[model samples]
Target chain A: MSVIEIKNLTRDYGGKGVFDLTLSVESGETFGFLGPNGAGKTTAIRHLTGFLKPQKGSCAVNGLDCWAESPKIHGSLGYLPGEIAFFDDMTGLDFLNFIAEYRRVKDKTRMRSLLERFELDARGKIKKMSKGMKQKVGITAAFMHDPAALILDEPTSGLDPLMQSRFIELILEENKRGKTILMSSHMFEEVERTCRRVAIIKNGRLATVDSIDKLKAAQVKKYVITLENEKAALAFAKEFAEEDVSETRVTVSIAGNIRELISQMNKYPVAGISMPGQSLEEIFMQYYGGNKNV
Target chain B: MFNATLFKSGIKGGIKTLALFCAVLTMYYLIIVQMFDPALGKMVQELAAAMPELMAIFGMNLNSATLTGFLASYLYGFIIIMFPMIFSILSVNRLIVRHVDGGSLVFLVAAPIKRRDVAFTQMTVILSGLLALTLYVSVLGIVASEISFPGELETGKFILLNLGALALHMFIAGICFLSACIFNETKYSVGIGAGIPVLGFIIQMLSNSGEKLEGFKYATFFSLFSTDGLIAMRPNAVWGMVALFFCAIALFISAIAVFTKKDLHI
Candidate 1:
């Protein structure tokens, strides 16, 4: 059964909000929501978290209406907002304690473990902490209760590379625990590493929703080859029908099996072969029709 | 529904401001009660005769020789109304508008608590703060009066006067709370929350300035709690308290309703 469901959700703020959006995440599945700024990713997540009321349709979590039964639904839901804001007057530990008290979390074992894993010194005042430290506090608050479902928006925005990797490991560990998770991010590699399925939203509409494997399969991979000489480069470019040929380098785009390219490259005296990393942005650009606004 | 944790935190947030207001009120009460004298009453009346407009603008009527009437004219005229109104405006804005505008309210609503419960808890905090301020002033008034001039203070009428002031402050708090709930931005909340009551005070002052503007008294809610009438045991004073109490109850209810159903951009 789907643990989270948004059906025909519509909230229009002068053409900036989500419109007739529908999506669902089944129990124990890790879903990725990919979009640029002003793409209504936060809007849809807010509806699921019950912070927004749908203008025309409805949303629900765990078989309960997101708007009408938000309090009941919140029992099993954990949400990390994109823009982190905490009580500046409180220390990190004091803020965590306050949330724990209201959530009725009697056992502090999980909270302590999360703080240790994040390497966050929570005794310091929140206002005195850096942006990355504040993000860590927000992450701990969302997961301290060990909810069945988690919704995180731009969860790793302020973290360093080391902390971002730690967050990915944490998400993977939670997924293994059969937790339903939906995360939104601009970092394609992060989504590619963690999510099974990804949904792309553009201009308040769903662009596409498919498995990560299928999207990768459809992505065009570009390879730049540095030959020994310009004569050899021309030959290779002609052989592959490549137009982006320079003095001693030829760039080839391969969409199908690489076996043919391997055999073809073996025939040439290739000095160096470097394959540029293929990002989801290029794939999104395909859908965006080369629009640079993304 | 109520959340004790939220309430405690809210009280912690506003206690300093409440204490500041209480300290100021205490100083004022001490000075006013100690300044009371039968001879001073005649002196004030003579001064009023000389500058009738200035005395009338402040709503000070020191013609009566009794302590209750003297306190009524001096304290209730402006000090009591302005202090509690300022307290309510600041408290109500901090309780609801600050949280919502700053986006910290998402933490509370994201928990297993309903939006209605959150709004109700904040409303409770504002009311509790106001009650504490009123109670402190009431106790100080009685103690200061009894300590200096024993049995000369009119205990019954003084209690009634404080009760009337409390009702008026509650009504003022209701206005502030309603504005806080209706607006999502701090500027709008503070503008409307502080604007209405200050405007009412101005109107009340204008009405008291002269006989030609006496009809302006009915335009502002401040005119409902008439200090002189309450001291004289007038029926209108009791009715005014009742009206203010009901209006407060109605405004608070509507605020909760509006908050529960409104879309929070936070």
Candidate 2:
């Protein structure tokens, strides 16, 4: 069952286009939306959450159109916006209480547990909270309803490594409870560690959607080979058409055929061999085409 | 239920607002007490006689131009325009600006609720807050008037007249709230919201002193609850003011419509 179905969505604001895009997430599946900064990740999430209306085409959550049936669809989904903004005047506890009222749910025990898990101070005013703390509040609010599906945009933003790890743990726990999750992040490891499938969005368009295993298998492989002797380097070059051929070491880029290439390369007296896995930044460049730091 | 929720928050916001208003008024009162000079009194008497029409525009009785009347004159002008403008701005800010600035609008909009429900709730808060503040000022203005000028005027009618004036301010405040919905940016919303009331004040000035612009009162919020019209017991002007109040309500509803359908992200 499709938890979310976005068909040719295009949203633009102030001349910055969140262009024609199409994607889907299946029920009980953890899908990763991979993109660099300003790659329309947040815009796409906003449209899904009904905070925005598509400039063209349709988007739905569980067959309910986002624009037409936001109220109903929203009830079945948990959403965490990219930038968490809170009412400063309200205490954290009061804010969550108000949110509970808005979500039409009461689970004080669960709410408390979430606060404790996030290590959040419920007594402090939201204005006084650190950025990471505010993000925790946003995360807690999204999960408090225990909705069937969670749409998280930059969910790990502003969290320290420990908290990020804890968040990953929580997400896995939620997934185990049969909750469908679509998490957008620039962190490859975060998605690689948690998501079964990943959707790479570039220029507000779907670049690729494949299982993590398949993505890893299809991922570009970079290998540096150092020749034992100058004679072996020439033979190695002759054996295979190489790239970035340097003085002692030569770096080669290969795709899914790295194993075959490596077997062929072993024909030469290779002094050193190293294969580096693709980073999130490398994959983002392969899809988005711009200068971005992971 | 919406009303109940609105009333609670609106009252909370309103109380904070009323405190600010009272503090300013108290400071003005003390200044007036300190500045009550005989030369200033005579000057005010001459000025009042010379401009009976202007006195009415400032919510002062032209017939009574003594020291007390002179002082009340300043207080009346302050409360009728400046004080109310500030009140309207802050109250509107409390509804829309506060939410946008605090990022609470994000949380509110994220819920499985109609956008109209969220906007209407804020509208309810604005209306309730304005009403409470108007009532408080009405009572306070009357008591202060009585203490300043013992046995000189009909304090209740004056209070009622002040209530009518405050009602007009509230009407504009309501428009300010609606304007907040029309504009997405908080600064723009607050600017236009605050600007419209000030424009109304300028129009009130034009209506009074600008002989060619006296007819502009029809557009200014000041004419909606003309204290002079109320004092002279002009039912037509009062009813016209009532019509303007209804117009504000229409604007308020339009705001709800726009907000519900329009895409909002903050």
Pick the DockQ winner.
Answer: 1
lDDT per residue (tens digit) for residues B1-266 in model 1 = 89999999999988999999999999999999999986777888888889887887877876346888888888888999899998898888777887789988889899899888898899899899888988888889889989998987888899898889989999999999999999999889889988999998998888888888889889998878988888778999889988999999999999999999988877
Which tens-of-lDDT digit does each residue in A101-129 have in candidate 1?
98888888989999999999999999899
Best-matching candidate per lDDT: 1
- The per-model lDDT (C-alpha) reads 0.88, 0.74
- Here the TM-score of candidate 2's chain B is 0.78
* lDDT of candidate 2 at residue B208, scale 0 to 100: 73
Runs in model 1 with CA error above 4 Å? A221-281, A287-294
Clashes of 1: 0
Lowest lDDT 10-mer window, candidate 1 chain A?
A285-294
TM-score of 1: 0.91
Per-candidate DockQ versus the true complex?
A: 0.65, 0.51
Models 1 onward score TM values of 0.91, 0.83
TM-score per model (chain B):
0.96, 0.78
Q: Candidate 2 chain A: worst 10 consecutive residues by lDDT?
A: A285-294
